[model samples]
Target: MFLHSRHLSRRVAIASATALLTGGAAAGAAWATTAAAAPAGPRTCTVSDLYVSMGRKEGAAGSLYWPIRFTNTGTTGCALRGYPGVSVLDAAQHRMGAAATRTGGAVSTVTLAPAHSASAVIRTTNGPVGGPCQATGTYLRVYPPASRTAVLVPAGWKVCSGTFRVAPVTR
Candidate 1:
């Protein structure tokens, strides 16, 4: 799926990333209990209900793994299942390469309470996987499962191949 930018400000990006890393402490207990035992949530999470952010990059097997977090910012719990639609975007807010392909993982619904989060890992190559390099990505456009709306998260990468893959969303 192609994601179109909404031209959000830098302040919004910082705030969203902050929420992913530090703002969900109080809700951890609820998140743990529900995510482990609860059934699928009553409603699916929408883009407006999530604050998306990218965690620190880790390198392995000649590829960089980015942990993309989706924190629930709404008042109620919502569900996230399967893989998120991910694509690299340039500074000009245009698609930089092919969208991510689902790699592997058990598909399970994660019910996130307000302030809690679920995550997916995106794997990108440091060297060309399929062809020569193109423009480096400045941001990622991520669509939560089952939603058309896209959330933009700041990123810096030059992915040359269509080999970019994303693991399924998990608790």
Candidate 2:
């Protein structure tokens, strides 16, 4: 038996679309591992377990808010001096702002309990165009220095980045 030409073309198109969808789903899952629940900040040492969530505030133009959580995954305690700041870039990767604040405040130290998580907020004064980040990348600096100097949260520590998305709030 022979199949019609139209049917054969349709089958090929469906297969290609399916493969693209599958690849996209896998990429999303891999990125999720980059951010995870953590155990606060370590004391007396430098350990990092930081997670950052990005979103836009209502009526806040050119601004992005970062709900940041820094935790200690190690056995010892560590001191977290500064939170990773926000960097907004345009389509051409031009630096719009650097090290933007997640929230307005002065945080010197935060001690994390074993197997616990500490949370903070960091925001940008000069923001991304259209009230949403053109591109959002978070950075964390380890105090007392750590085995690794700094971690760009989006690059994915073990796997792909957690979730770098535009969470728009409607009404």
**Total clashes in model 2, counting residue pairs 3 or more apart in sequence or in different chains:** 16
Cα lDDT for residue 80, candidate 2: 52
Model 1 TM-score is 0.72
Model 1: lDDT of residue 94: 94
Q: lDDT values of the candidates? A: 0.81, 0.40
Quote model 2's TM-score.
0.38
Model 2 misplaced stretches (Cα beyond 4 Å) = 1-63, 85-97, 101-103, 125-148, 155-171
- Alpha carbon deviation, residue 98, candidate 1 (Å): 0.9
Best by lDDT: 1
Cand. 2 Cα-lDDT: 0.40
TM-score of each: 0.72, 0.38
Query: Model 1, residue 19: what's the lDDT?
Result: 54
